[model samples]
Target chain A: MKIAHHAHKDIVIPNSTRHLVTVRQAVFDVIQESGFPEHEMLRIALAIDEALSNIMEHAFETENLKAELTINLSLDADEEKFEALILDSGKEFDPGEIESPDILTHVASGQKTGLGIFLMRQVMNEVKYTFVSGFRNELRMIKYAHDFKTKGATNAGTQDHYQNH
Target chain B: MPELKITTKIIDHDITLIRLVGFLDAHTFEELDVVINDLFEKNIHKIVADLSALEYISSAGAGVFIGALAAAQENSGNIILAAANENIHEVFDLLGLTQIFTMTDSVETAAKAFECNA
Candidate 1:
């Protein structure tokens, strides 16, 4: 199947903790517009939230950094993919330096940090980060439609129920 | 802005049951962290977080609980999660939190676990 439908959105929010709520809501609305299931939407939202949080805490590193987070979400029906490109004007940090914390050991030691990177990886099908230019970083996250779709289901059919625990 | 409303009630002397509403991300996680720390400082070890109303969570929110687990456990108490929807559970599962924290289907069950532990 090719992209029978598609939509794109761009959101710019101040790089401050106060604007996180606004960013999450705008991104959630875009993801919902793609007509994905709720579970997938939550995952995508969580990933975006974590990515933005990382940028705010680590990239900006100050309360009043005078920066903005530019996020673009693209939904492609033909490719069956939902993609988000988050661009920021912040310091460049190599993602290779971070490792997923071992939950048992990390918790036993009372360490509260380091789950952000891990969560981003798990929630999205693909996550890529790059320094496009000086003071500019891009983090692209994508989720495939089939990951939430059942076998032999039509593309027009939307999954309504979440996999309840 | 992303919002998180935390309403707390004390049950069984030291058991604090907190209802979380709205989104818990990097921005609003500190609210929960401060609340939990305040409870711990008061020697309240048992905490049951009812997350049914919580619409979303990220690593920051999850970290707050992990960060407090040791302190809570040291005082013979723990953070019990109740009524987490599949989305939250999936996030918890990603970090192996299901194995680290006590998760129950209902707040009553989570509270009862504290009684048994006590």
Candidate 2:
């Protein structure tokens, strides 16, 4: 009998929304290869899209900042879990501090944006953020296959790690 | 490149059916925002977005509808989403938007929703 090894992929692209579609397709391919259920594959892809969108819109706001910056993405998946590590050299952002909006109040108030982070948190089992002053920002998101089967499992089983070094 | 194709049809003089094809993400959400805003400028608030051909949607895409919903309602009109595939529906469900937005099985049903509201 032979054992299959984990699959890993790394991609680097300019910090621009133009490449989001390509990135998404690549993410989906990896998830599908990892044997994730069809429903969970789309959810995972959405989480990555939201994270990258935030980095582009907030972290690299200025044209000058975007001109020189690049986003480094890594995907690692095995039979047990799928993990994504996104690295960018832009401004630091902590999604944890932003309060989750009450959906009814949010829409009634005529707000359109601010829902990306909420969606990311909802789909992924782990969302960890780390920043090194004047260096880089790292966001690691993970989803366990088992977690999807047991939906609404408490956050006690996952880690929401945020660190500043 | 990110692509989103949007086409509009006038239904019964009041409602407009906008068909969306391709991916709706951060890169292409503004195109939708512009189209919907254009409709509002023409006093065409009753809208039915036919999403059967839509391949994908992110929060940015969903935001376009959220921003326009209040304006439509205040003008005695509404935006109903119809024929969203299962994956698209999941995005709405994750955002808690399934509760706020009216969704139907097809464009015809969506247009009827506007009639019922009237």
* Cα RMSD, each candidate: 7.2, 2.5
True-contact fraction for model 1? 0.92
Best by lDDT: 2
- Give the lDDT of residue B80 in candidate 1: 96
- The lowest-lDDT stretch of 10 consecutive residues in candidate 1 chain A is A156-165
lDDT of 2 by residue, A56-159 (tens): 99997677768578899999887678899999988899888777789999899888799999998898888889998999999999988777544555653444
Quote the true-contact fraction of every model.
0.92, 0.83
Second chain TM-score for model 1 = 0.96
- The TM-score of predicted model 1 comes to 0.84
CA lDDT for candidate 1: 0.74
For model 1, how does the per-residue alpha-carbon lDDT over A77-127 read when each residue is reduced to its tens digit?
Answer: 223677787777777854535776777898898887888777777666666
Which lDDT tens digits does candidate 2 get at residues B1-118? 3399999999868999999999999999999999999999999999999999999999999999999999999999998999999999989998999999999999999988888878
Q: What is the two-chain DockQ of model 1?
A: 0.75
RMSD of 1: 7.2
Give the range of the ten consecutive residues with the poorest summed lDDT in model 2 chain A: A149-158
Error of 2 at B54 (Å): 0.5
